[model samples]
Structures are given as structure tokens and as C-alpha cells.
Target: MKQLGSKIRGFFNTRLGFFALAVALFWAKTYWAYQTKFNLGVSGKMQNLLLVLNPLPTTILLFGVALYISGRKSYITMLIIDALTSLWLFANVLYYREFSDFMTFSLIKGSSSVSSNLSTGVMGIMRASDWLVFVDVAILILLLAFHVIRMDTRPIKKLFAVGVTLLAGLMFGSNLSMAYHDRSGLLTRTFDNNYIVKYLGLNAYTVFDGVKTAQTSATKANAKASDMNSVLVYLKKNRIDPNAQYTGVAKGKNVFIIHLESFQQFLIDYKWDGQEVTPNLNKLFHESDTLSFDNFFHQVGQGKTSDAETMMENSLFGLPEGSAMSLLGTSNTFQAAPAIMDQQGYTTAALHGGVASFWNRDNAYKSWGYDYFFSKSYYQNIKNDFLGYGIKDKLFMRQAAGYIEQLPQPFYAKLITVTNHYPYPLDKKNQSIAKTDTGDKTVDGYVQTAHYLDQAIGEFMAWLKKTGLDKTSMIVFYGDHFGISANHKDAVAQLLGKDSFDDFDNAMFQRVPLMIHMDGLKGGINHTYGGEIDVLPTIMNLLGISNKGYIQFGSDLLAANRNQTVAFRNGDFVSPTYTKIGSNYYDTKTGEQLKKLTQAQKEAVDAMTNRVTTELSLSDRVVNRDLLRFYTPNGFTKVDKSDYSYTQSKALEMLQAADDKNKTSLIDKNNGKSTMNEYKTDAPEMAGLKEFADSYSSSSSSASSSSGTTSASSSSATSDSSDKDK
Candidate 1:
């Protein structure tokens, strides 16, 4: 042991040994960050290898520069380089905590206005282990100071430095080649920033982001009103006339958009061990007053849920790369649903259980003209209230009932649920059903989490009835994106009882549930092919709102002659007649590959492909160049973002100040009292918390008996048998 220690110390006396040690330490630190801090969706042995090996190339490339310097200056330069690189990583760590995305140069340049609040914001988001980011630097500095690892004063040869640079280049080339082999168009058609950092390293991703940001900036700078000409022409030509049967049916009613996170259409009627996966949702789907679409797909790219939101709100597809909400929605002008509804005398609000900064929603909602944003701070989060992404669905919905009752009548509200998110986890006490035997842990837990979300929805729906909100509101429940990724192909295939999975199966698995329910509207399952992009137009038609002057790329799905081609984010298109996956084509009905296409089939494919390509390209142009700033639809006023604040005090003040008699809030109608008692949940975490409707009514009755008089509000709080599920 003594001899080995002496030999290691002897090697540390050499310059090359010192450089090697520094590079190894940096590599280990970066890999640790990749594993612990970021959710990069690492899968497969190849990806695992890449994750371990990627940082070495970048570390060598950056630190190799110090080797060119002579004597103690080389050691100093290396330490400085190490410190700066580590600082950048730490900055991304902080940024990722808020945005769930990496720090881009564009974001940095745009953060000057918030610099004063940086200290408070940083403190709020700081984790206990965040200090570990600079621990290696401190350790090295201390070691040198204590002379435990002496800094060699020997000069390095220029030839050796040049060789090191070559080695780094070779390693990076190899990594890039492997990544491309695993996922095509990794650089040019970049989808997720996580993929970039996972396949390469943080340093490479930063450089890539810098280049993309510059390109986007240039595009926005040179954009003109004339550039919108092509987009306007395409939309006008493709616009669908609204169906008279559905048009104006929901006009003047409240709008409730319930976002079911990570939900897929297959779960609607699916069964496991003879038990329904989503019994409540299934009932909703089969209800007489619901308009359900079985062919609806969630066409989210790497942005996933945020991409779905962008499409649902603005009829604009997410960027082909990262989240549009995080990258452009904050600054871009949007003729969004909230703004249009606000102009039509409706109060607009967004309710989410997650942080306001997730996907940059706090700023984006304001840009979209939301009058109120009830984010994480608006909810009471206890120890067991949170699970995957944010607050558990049951607790979030129960708490959100109070906020919903505060919104004035004829309101447009969006409630985003996050319990059914990826890497689904549920506590033993909270899980209502058994997990699936899919072998893959992620897929197995997905079923249980989904079941929990369904129960939450059932409870909230009953609450809406108990409070009489259902009488005047139209609730729309839609899945945001797929819960299981393609990485779990074997598990998914097993669940479906299929022999194997392919691109065709993967494409079909993108279908998500879209159910719109009203009090007395005629409803049935519609098989029209559509994606999230079509939601805005479909809802607008039902609300008697004309999207004629808006530059929306989607057609009204209720229209008898509306287009049925649904475009995916990756340039794939699905139609009732055919489905295209990569370069391959298959008959939608027969599921047979089109190896030999007839002339007519070839022509049809060419035409549809052109339309899909043009639409995606135009949408990308709209977001990347911020082209909507150039035009505003008639009867619409551009939103002033400064008029809104999402703080607890400001949101409550706005709710209290609403004095319109014709559009009084639910709380006002209920004698200015809270309606939260109407909501009930079976969540074990909420045990002993007694605000359930039946219990509240029983207590009210007892009080009335003691007082010998019943107030009108108390009398109306009795349980209704009609509200119970039959």
C-alpha cells in the first residue's frame, strides 16, 4: 500500500499525469450531473455508453488548450477553464429547475429585466446538493494549497497538445456517428435538448443552442408583413365551413378545458384483469351529451405537453425542436383562445398545479391574455400532495374548485393535471389499482397512475354538478400526449397482445382521447382524423366564433367536408385512407405496406405529403420568426401582457373586483361563500379532511336545526341524487 501510494504521488509530479487527472475529474463530475440532475430519458445500452463517454470528448477539447501553455501558467489556465465550464453547468441546473429546459443565450440576453429578482428566485429554487457543482474545483484548489498534489512546473510540448486535440476530435466524431446511427437527423432535425445533452454533452448542446438561437434571431429580424402572405393564403384556401348542427350550440356557455397529462386513447376502454383502466373516462366517452373523437392524435414533438398546449391554444404547432412555449411563446404575439374569448366578454384563466415557470407558462399565459393564472402557489401542497410532475390530481382538483368558483360566468378556463406524467409513480396507499405486469417499470406504473387520474376527474365532475356549474358549462377533456414512449416497445406490444411492434404501430399509438361534454347536446363518437392543431377551430365553431380572419392552419372538425389529414410533428401524416411513417406508406384500413403503389396512389401520397410539409414549415416559420406580431384579426385587441400578474394577492384581487351583475361568479351566486365543500376525493393523503358535500350539508342542517331557521344558501347545499353516477 505504501509503495502504490508513493508511485501514484510520483506520477502526480509529472505534467501529463496532472492534466490526465484533471480531465478524469471533470468527466466524472459531468456524468454525475447527467445522472442525478437531468431527466434525459436515457435508454438502451448504447445510450448508456454514450452518456458515460460523451463528456470526455468535450472535456478534453476544452482542457487540452491549457496543455499548450508552459509551466504553472498551464495549471492556472486549466483550473480557470474548469471553473468556467462548471459555472455554465451550474447555471443550466438553475435554469432547468424553473423552465425544465437548458439555458440558451437568447434567454440570458432577455433576462435583464428580472435581474433584480435573481437573488430571491435563485434562493427559492436552490437545492441542498446544488453546491456540489463546484465541489471538485474547491477540492482541487485545496489539494494544491495543502501541497497534497503538487502542481508540476514542467513545460508541455506543443506536439503533445496538438495530439490531444486530434484525439478529442476523433472521440467527438465517433460519438456523433453513434448518435446519428441511433436517431437520424440528430443535428439538423433536432427535437429535444435532452437528446442533445444525452447523446453528446452539455458543452456541445450549449454550442448547438447558440447556433440555433442565432439562426432564429436572424430569421425574426428580417421577417416582414409580406412574409405572412403565403401562410394567410394557405389557411384561407384550406378553411372549412362550420356545421350548422354544432355551430352556436355552446355559445354563451362556460368553457372548461381539462388537460389529461400523458393519457392515451387506448386507456379509454382498456381493461386489465377484467378491471377498467379508466372507468370514469370511459363513462364520459360513452355519455349521450359527449362528443368523442376516437381518431384524435396528440401531435406533440420533443416539447410533448407544451407542444400540445401551443396547438390547442393557438392552432400553431410546436417548434420541430424544443418547446415553443419555452423558446418563443413568451415573446411572440398569439391570436390565442384566451385572447379571443376575452374579447367576447368571457373571463379567461389558466389553472395549473405546477410551478408558473414550467415551460415558461407564467409569461406565455399573459401573452395569450389570460386574466388569471392559478399556479402551484395557489394550491396547498402538503408532504404527500405532490408526486410526479406537480400536485397529485385529486388534491389539485379539490383545491382548484375554490378558484373555479371565483371565475365569473361565461368564463374560459384551462386546468392542467400532471399526476399521469412520465415515469409514473404512485404511493401504495394512493394507488387504487394493481400495476400492470409489463416487465418494464415505467409501463407498469403508467396504468396505476392513469387510474388515479380518472378517479380524480370523477370526483371533480361530481363537484361541478353539486355546485350547479355543470348546468352552464361545457367541459372538454383531452389527453396531452403519450404516456409510454417508443423505448418501451416490447412492453407496449405485450400489453396490446401483438407479436411485435413497428413504425406503423408506433404511429397509431399516438392517438389520444378527446371528449367534449355539455348538459343537453347531442353527442357520438366521431371518426374524423385530426390532431391537437384542430382543437381550436373545432371549439371555436361550437362556440359560434368565426376563425375566418385568423391565420389558423386547422379546419373545423365538425364540418361535414372538413379535411381529415392529421399531421404529426416529425413530418409524418395520418389520414383515414393512408398512414405515412418515414419513407414507408401503409393502407390505413388494411395495415398493409405499400411496396408497389399505383399511379393514382402515388399521386395522392405526393399531394398529401406536400400539404403536410407546407403546413409544418409555415407553422415553424410563424413561431421562429414571431410573424403574428405583424397581423391582428378584426374585432380583436392585442393583449397587453403588463395588465396581468399571477401572484396570489393579485389574482384574488381581480376575482373580488369583478362586479358585473349579468356575469356573476359561482361564489357570488352562492352568497359569496366558498364552494370547495362540494368536492370529495378518496385519496388516502386527504384523510380526516372533511369538506365533502354530504358531510358539509349534514353539518349545515344540524346548525339550521339548532338556530330554528335555514338560510337559502344552506337549504340549497343538500345532496342531489341526480349528481351521483348511475
Candidate 2:
């Protein structure tokens, strides 16, 4: 075999061999998955393990198959390179921990963990099955590449030559394609001079890509603060009440707002798998008016659950046009229920089982109007028996009960639960709640947590009954966001059952369990179009509160007038940028894009979109920070220091700091350790300088000197302006 020309040189230059290597090492990735499962530390959840095993193997297969179809050389380095590269891919996914986290059982809970290998194998099977076809293609490529590369003979020389030519062409094409994707700063300077010179009207040979960089920056700058306010005003002119109560919910009620961590809609199906998994939540909706907003969606223009909460609770919209949750707690002020209640004469309190401020929750809540904030420390020293992430629902519930008893007559208290958190790692060691025999993994943990929380809620409600405060109080309960993406898909599949993927069925993620349980309110399923933003106005409407001058994205959940939805892309990287109306997506940034919705429908949707945008901007900029004042779009009469959060550094310098100091806290005494928030909903909330934020949270008078409002707790939603926590 005589080699001539640049054939040998070309083969070495190509990455086809590396692709083959990746395929060979795909099987060995099992060890990585197993190691991550058990040794990810006490804080890690089973879900983290699940996240480890996703998509990498399949990608490895793709690399191998492409190489087999293209390359001429058979090599041992292929396997070695593949394993190393596969590990790299695994590490990246684990670091981001977004899609995978939602897919896996939480490692911290160890609910997904198993002492017995049999159960663990069953889960492993599921993870392995997802990549089976990819593996098959990879193995086939390796054997075939070996046979074809070393083929010998003379009469068959023509066929062999033809095969060789085609293989070389394929390899070259694949490499070129790969290069196209690596268009980073360094890459462009090195590779794409010709294309850059043409499209961008630049000198290809020059290293200065400054003009292109400036243009991209300018486009991003165009996404200004008012984008959020535009949505708010548009909402008033077209959708529900123009002026609605900004905050200050019903007083004296034990408001249990369990943002069921990653609680997706797929979990709600009445698929009594011989027994009901979510029997309590599903059944609760029966006695309560379940605001089953079928067309409602997540206003997540940016982060996942973090974005969902910011959009919903703050009555804000859009992501910060950058990374979501990364800039949490920094927003000066936003419309949170507690903030609203604080304005309308309510002593606000917040409770979550997680760390004090994982996602800047501590500072962010202070901006949201909570007078008292409670996290893991609030429930301190008690057996955090459940896991490293948070205390069990039962423990949280007990604390909530005590807080409720201490609250003034007209008070607001929120309790966010973690029992139903991923991997549903049941702390069955000491809990009194008897576990039901549910064979399904997802169903078992979900049901158990749901049931336990349900019992806790029921006990709380029973206490309210005993105190005689149950009749007048209004309670809002809903899942903050869906639990997992897979659960949402599975639910959609359950509806369609073994068919093509339905984008519309993606509702399980956006559509969650929402209910307003009040003594006088009618009980039944209210299957209207609604979402997180709409909850505020709906509650106000029921209480007969007049919100004539407020600016918010929410409408009365029970109101007859229908409202549309607006969406945000947590980390936007495109145009048409996922801005939408309810479930229907159309790109008419300046006009009504969806013809399916009539003039009224168009108005409703456009208005909502604008409102969501407005609220997001306003909250982000820290407007309407009056703790006692019900904030309107214009209600934010005074700018406080807290409302003007400054521009933060984009990179995680703290991670670098930890590296520099060689000081890390997560190392387990027994094994090892770990962790992960983002948002934007405001009316142009960015401050030119940090000095401007001085007056953000300043309220002139305590509730005592007010024309309306009680000292620590108001008697009711105070009608007087002085009650506003400005």
C-alpha cells in the first residue's frame, strides 16, 4: 500500500478518529454514573445521579458513527479519546445541572438512592435505555471501520479506491461542519476570515472584530428597562382591571404557598395506578375552586423554576436579557405577595425549607415585602433529617403553625415546602405518616410527599377552624413550577399515549396546581386560561378590594374577561425570542402576530405580554418598594435605595475566589458535597449607579401612626393609604 499526496496528512488533521474513540468509551461511562450516584455527597440527591447519565452516551455514539462512516484508519486511540471526551461532556452537563437536575431524582434525598442493587439497576436500565440505539450504531461503526480501512486486493482496487475517496470526503465535510460551530472570538480570528469579511463587511485578514462585537452589544442594549412597563400599560388598556391591588392579600389566614420544587403538571393525572399517587392535591381541588388555567404558561423568559417564581410572584415579566437566577436577590424591589400584604396592613412572613438565601432569597424576599423571613436557620437545629437540601415538610409545617398563631389579626404568612422535592427521598426513618404501597418510583415519592404535606396543611386548617379565623381568611395555594421536564413529557404522552410529541401538551410545565380556598368561595374546577401572574388580581377580586389604579400583569382569576399570556426565554439567544400569547407563539413584537386570536384576543395577549414585560422591569429596578402601600404601575411614587440594585459582575468570581483561597465548605465529613437562582420583572429598574438605591425600602411611618393599619398586624386589608408599607 503506497501512500502519496497529502492523504496521510489529511487523515491526521481530521477528528474522525476522535469520534471513533468516543464511541468505544461510551460503555465505560457507566462507572462515572455509578460513582456520582453514591459518592456525590450527602447534599446530592438521587436526581443528580439521574442527571449524570443523560445524553452524553448518545452524543458519544453520534461522534463514533460519523467517524466510522467517514474515516479510513482504524485506531486504539479512538476509544481512549472517546472516554476522555465523554467524561468532559458529562462534567459540563453536571455543572449546568439544569435539564439533568429536573430529570434525575434528587441525590440529597437519597429517595432515589438504594441500599439494594436491584432497585438501583431498574433505574439504571431506564438511563441506559435512553442511549441504547446510540451505542449500537457506535459498535457497528468501529467494526466496519476496521474492516474497510485495512481492505486488501488488486482487481477490487477500483471499488476500494472509490470507497476511500467517499470516506475522505465525508471526513473532511464533518470536520468543516465542526469548525463552523466553534465560532468563538479566538476561532473567528483563526478560521472564518473569508465569511466574516463578506457578511460583516470587514477585512477578513484583520484581527479586529470590534465592529461586529459593537453591533451585537447594541442589539442587546436595545432591550431596555421599559420593555417590562410597556407590557403593563398594554395589559391595562386591553386585558382585565387597569387598576388592581398590587399586593396586601387577605389577612389572618395561614397562607401556605408551597412552591412545590419542580412539581410538574404530569404529576396530577388521575391515573390511579391501582392507587392514587397525588390523592391529596388532586382531591383538594375538588373542594376548592381549582383554577385549572388550561392555556396558562410559564412567563419564564430566562431561568427555569427561578424565572417562574420571579414572573409569578413579582407580577413581573421577562428575564434580565442575560443569565437567569444568577442575579437573584439583587433586584431592588418587586411585587411579592408579602410586599403587597405588607402595604395593605399585613405583617408579612416567609418560610422555605432551603438555605437562608440560596438564590438570594433572603435579600430578595426583603425587597418582596416580607417583614420576617425564615429559611433553614429559622427552623434551626431541628432534625433536618430529610437531607442536606432542606428540612422535611412536616418540620416546616410545624414551624408554620407557630408563626401563624403569632401573626396579627390581618396577617400574611407563606410556607414553601420541600417534601415533594425531587428524588422524593423519603425520610421514613422517623416520620409518623404511614407510607402507602405505591410500586412506581416517581409516583411513590411524589404521593408520599404530597400526602405528608397535605396532612400538615389539613392540620393547620383544622387549627384555623378551632380559632374561628377560617371564615374570613383567603388562602392561595399553587405549585411554583413543575418538578421535572420528563414528568411533563410523560404526562403529555399519557394523554396522547405512544404518539408524536405534542408541543401544546407542554402545558404540564406551565400549568400547575392552582387554588383559592376560602370558606365562602364556590368550590369546583375553574378551567379558564390563567397562570402565576393572574393569581394576585383574582384573590383581590374575591376580597372585594378596589384596585382602580394598579398596574400588574395578573387579572381576576374568576373574572369573566379572559387574559392572554406572555413568555420569556430565560437566557435569550434568538429573535422572535420566545415572546408569546398563552400557548400560541407568534413573532409580532410591534403588532398582533397571532391571527388565530381575534381583535379582542390579540389585544388581550398583547396587553398581557406588555404587562409581563413591565412588571419584570419594574421589580428588577426596585420600584414600588412601599412595604405598606399597594403598588400600582404608577404607585411606586418614591424610589428607595433597595429598589436600585447595581450592575453585578457577570462571571462567578466567588467560585474563582474559592479556588484561590482553597477554601470550600461543601466537603462532606463522611463523603463529599455540593449545589444552584435567576429573574427579571420590572419597569426599567436598572440603576445608573449603586448610590441611587439609598431610599428604596424607606417607609415614613410605622403602622401605628398611620391613618389606617394596625401596629404589627392590621385588622384587615386596610383601606387607608397610610397602611401602605412605603
Candidate 3:
């Protein structure tokens, strides 16, 4: 036994043994990650085993180079490399918990913002068991500190180390080729980061993400304004005039846009266990004043929810790849909804319960010409109210009541709900709906949270009515994107009682609810073949606004001559007659594949394909080149982003200014007191948080003064102070 122990110690103390140990530790941690942290899907046993082994060669090639150096310096280099690798793994674990995604180089570059946005609440996501990832590192450090494995003086033979690295490289190449053979285009045309990590290891994904990021940056750097000219001409030539009857239908009215997070249209009238999934939404769908579109789909790409916002606000498409909000939002100029509304004397604000920095929204909102933004910080008593991305939908809507009342009349405001987000987890106490026995927890929880969201929206609508705003305001409710992904399709098929969901069903699943309600408008379900991109132009037309001079890609959906080709970001398109997804063509009426089309049908499909490509490419050019910076619409002044800030105090500043001026501010009209008390809900969380609501109400009243001149001066002084602090 003593002889065996001595031999083991001698081997560990040698240079080659130490190199072997490093590689072994890296492989173990990577496998651990693959087994625990990542959801690589059920890609069969062989593919899953290949994914576990794929990282080994890359790990060796990366850390093996240090073997060429001599003495302690070599050891130090290996230690640094291992430490960085461990740190990267650790970061992916944390990031994946939040985004269900691995870290990209772009996200890493923006880590400072992410770190700043993180709160103590993040500690809840960290599991005590996750410390297993560091067990090997800890053991290695302890051994080195105790001199149990002293740094060997001898260097590894350079030729052997180089040969090992080259052999590993060749093996990795072969492994990747096999992966591609198993999953066609495994390395190319990957839309989801999860797919890359699924087939190739996280290390491979990081390298791939870095390459994609570099390519995007290079494209942006080389982009020119002239590249958008063709796009502009196409958009102009294809632009349709607004229907005379519908123009100015909701002119000079307040606009309340409720963004339903991860909501799909199937939930609109869906029934499960004899209970309607969205009872309130069902009522809204049938309301005489509502115009609900049954066929409107959510056309978003990688940006997802943020992309929906971009398309709705600017009538523009998201990037073909990464999130446009994160990649280009801060730099890109936009002819957005808020900016267009500003021309018509509308006060624009965006209220989201999430961190403003999540998608770089704090800066993006400024560039989008939003005069006010109420982010996560604006909500009271929310330190414990959050679930996934931000506060619960119930709490968010309840908290937004005070802020909404403060906005000036004829305002453009958006309320973004997040409780219905993916992996939808609802507290047992909050789950009023029955859970599905489909065995898919995500699908089961989706229905419950969606019901909760509907209740929240119903409460908010009631509050609008109590405040007499509902009568005068146009309420637009739309789903941002899909709640369930293709992975859950089988379970969803069972839930929907389908034999099997094919591509046709998948296409239909993309449909999201778009409802517009105004007091005097005639209501009926409109079978409009539109997407989120059409929202801006539709809203503009109803409000007596025109996008004729602006570079908009979507036409007004309400227009009699509206161009209804719903172009998706991924070069797919859907029209009333046909649905073209990638290379497949389907009859929209029958949902049957058209393997061989008539010449006229073929011509129509070809024209649409060309149009879709042009639209997407032009939108990319406009965003990539920041074309709006070079072209301003006639009679529209370019927005000075410096004029806006989303700091916590800005909400109060705006309210105070409105009070001092005794102008369009709702607070001043309400006699300097918040109308939040008028807002009522049955949310359990809200009942206990009444004191928090009262505080907001009382604070507003306390800040008001009878003397207008003195109040104006004080507000001016406060604004100046805030500016200096900035």
C-alpha cells in the first residue's frame, strides 16, 4: 500500500501527470455541465454521448500549449487558463438560469451592465449544490498549497505536446463533421444558441458565438446609407393609403398598449378541464367595441419579445441573427411610435416590470423618443414580488396604476407583463387553474400563468374605467410571442387533442391575439393577415397620423388596399392565400402542402419570396447603417436622445413638472393625489401591499404645493440638480 501511494504521488508531481490532471478536471466539469446545466434535448443516446466527449479534444488543444513551456511559469500559465475556463463555465451556469441561454461574446462585453442590473434577488437562483462544479478546482488548489504536488522543473517535450494538440484538433474536426452529418447544417444557419450547445459543447458554442459577433460588428462597421436606398424605394412604392373611413377614428385619444408576454392565440378561447384558460380575454374578444384579429401572427426572430416591440414601434424588422435591441438599439435611430405620437402632442411612456438594462432598453427607450420609462425600480414593494424576469403580472399592473395616472392625457403608454414567461412557474397559492396531466411541466404551468395574466389585465382595464380613462383611451392588447416552443409540441398536441402537430400546425401556433378596443368603435373579429410589424401603421392611421415620409416597412392593416403579405424575419412569409415557410409552400385555406404549383401560383410564391428577402435585407441595412440618422421624415424633427433619461427620479420629475405647469398632467387634474386607490384587484400579493400603494399616492400629494410659481421654480432646481448628478 505504501509503495502504491508513493507511485501515485510521483506521477501527480510529474509535468505530464499535471497536464493530464488539468485535462481530466476540465472534462469532468464539462460533462457535469452537460448533464446538469444544459437542456441539450433528447437527441438520442449516441448524439448525447458524442456531445459529452466532443469538448475533450478542444480542452486539450487549448490547455496543452502550456506544456511546451518550462518550470513554474508553465504551471502558472496552465493555472490561469484553467481559472478562466472555470470562470466561463460558472458564468454560463448563472446566465443560463436566467436566459436559458449560454453567454455570447457580445453579452460578455456587456457584462458590466448585466452585473449592475443584478440584485440580491439573484442569490435565490444560486443553488448550494452547484458548488460541486468547483470541487475539483478546490482540491487542486489545496494540493498545490500543501506542496502535495510540487511544480515539476522539467518541461514536456515540445514535439509531443504539439503532436497531441494537432491530433486533438483533427479529432475535434472529425467529431464536428459527424455532428453535422447527424444534424444537418449543425454548424450553419443555427437560429438558437441552445442548438449549438446541444450538438457541440459550450466551449465550441463560445467560439462560434464569438465568430458570429465579430461578423456582425464587421458588417455594422462597413454598412453604408446608400444600401438602404433600394429598400426605401421599395417601401415607398409598395406603401398603401389609409382607408378614409377609418382615418382619425381614435384621434387625440390616450393609447394604452398592453404587451402580453409569451402569449399565443390558441389560449384565447381554449378550454381545459371545463374551465376557460383566459375568461377575461374571451369576454374582451366578444366586446362590441373591440376589433380582434383571428389570424394575426407574431413575427419575431432571435430578439423575441424585444423584436416584437421593435416591429410594433418602428414598423421595422429585427436583425436576421442576434437581438437587435441588444446589438444595435443604443446606436440605431428609429422612427418609432413614441416619436411619431410626440408630433401629435402625445406624452409617451413605457412601463415594464423588468430591468431597463435587460435588452439595453434604458438607452434604447431614449433613442426611441420615449419621454418617460418606468422600469423595475419604479415599482414599490417589489423586492420579493418577482418570479422570472421581473415582478409578477398582478403586482406589475397594480403598481403601474399610479404611474399611468401621472402620465399626461393623450398619452402613448405600454404595459409589459412578464409572469407568463417561459418555464412559467406560478405559486401554488396563486394557481387557480387546474394543472394539465400532460407530463410536461412547462406546458402545464403555461395555462395557469396565462390565466393569471388575463386576470391582471382585466383588473387593469377595470382601473382604467374607474379613472374614466377607458372611455377616452384606445386600449390595444397584443401577444408578444409564443409561450411554448417546438420542443413542447408533442405535449401541446396531446393537450390540444391532435393526432400530431405538423409544420402547418406549427405555423398556426405562431398566431397571436391582437385586439384593439375603443368606446365608440364597431367591433368584430377581423381576419387580417398581419403581424406585429403592421401595428404601428395601423395605430398611426387610426390616430390621424401618416408614415408616408417615414421609412416604414408595414402598411396600415385597416387600409382597404392594405398590402397584407406578413413577412417573417427568417425569410418566410404568410398571406391570405398561401404560407411559405423556408422551401415549403402550403395552401392557407386547406393547410395542405403544394408539392407542384401551377405557373400562376409559382409566380405568386416567387414574387412573395423576393419581397420577403428584400424587406428583411433592407430592414437589416437600415438598422446596421443607422439610416434614420441620415434621413428625417418631412415635418418630423430628428429626436435628440440626450433629451431623455430613464433614471428613477425622472418619473417624479415629469410628474412634478406637470403639476407645476398645471397643464396636461393627470396628477394635477386629479388634485395632486394618485388615483391608484381607484384601481382594484383580487391579487393576493396586492392585498398585503396596499401600504406600498398608499405610499406612492401620499408622496405625490405631499410633493404638491398651492403656489404654482414656487413649485415651478423648485422643479427646475430639482431638474438642474439631477442633471449635475448625471
Best-fitting candidate, scored by TM-score: 3
Residue-level lDDT tens digits of model 2 in 402-520: 33443444556677776665555665553334443334354345555665555555655565555455665666667766544433344345433545433333433355677666665
Q: Model 1 residue 479 lDDT?
A: 96
Q: For each candidate in the order shown, give its overall lDDT on alpha carbons.
A: 0.81, 0.43, 0.78
Please give the TM-score that candidate 3 achieves against the real structure.
0.78
Measured by C-alpha RMSD in angstroms, how accurate is candidate 2? 17.2
Judged by whole-model lDDT over C-alpha atoms, candidate 2 comes out at 0.43
How far out, in Å, is residue 321 in model 1?
2.9
lDDT of 1: 0.81
Residue-pair clashes per candidate: 0, 82, 0
Give me the displacement of residue 185 in model 3, in angstroms: 10
Clashing residue pairs, candidate 1?
Answer: none
Rank the models by lDDT, top first: 1, 3, 2
The parts of candidate 2 lying over 4 Å away from their true place are 2-88, 91-233, 242-256, 264-273, 288-298, 318-328, 428-444, 487-501, 544-551, 565-726
Q: lDDT (0-100) at residue 424 of candidate 2?
A: 56
- Model 2 per-residue lDDT at 94: 38
Question: Where's the lowest-lDDT run of ten residues in candidate 3?
Answer: 707-716
TM-scores, one per candidate: 0.75, 0.54, 0.78
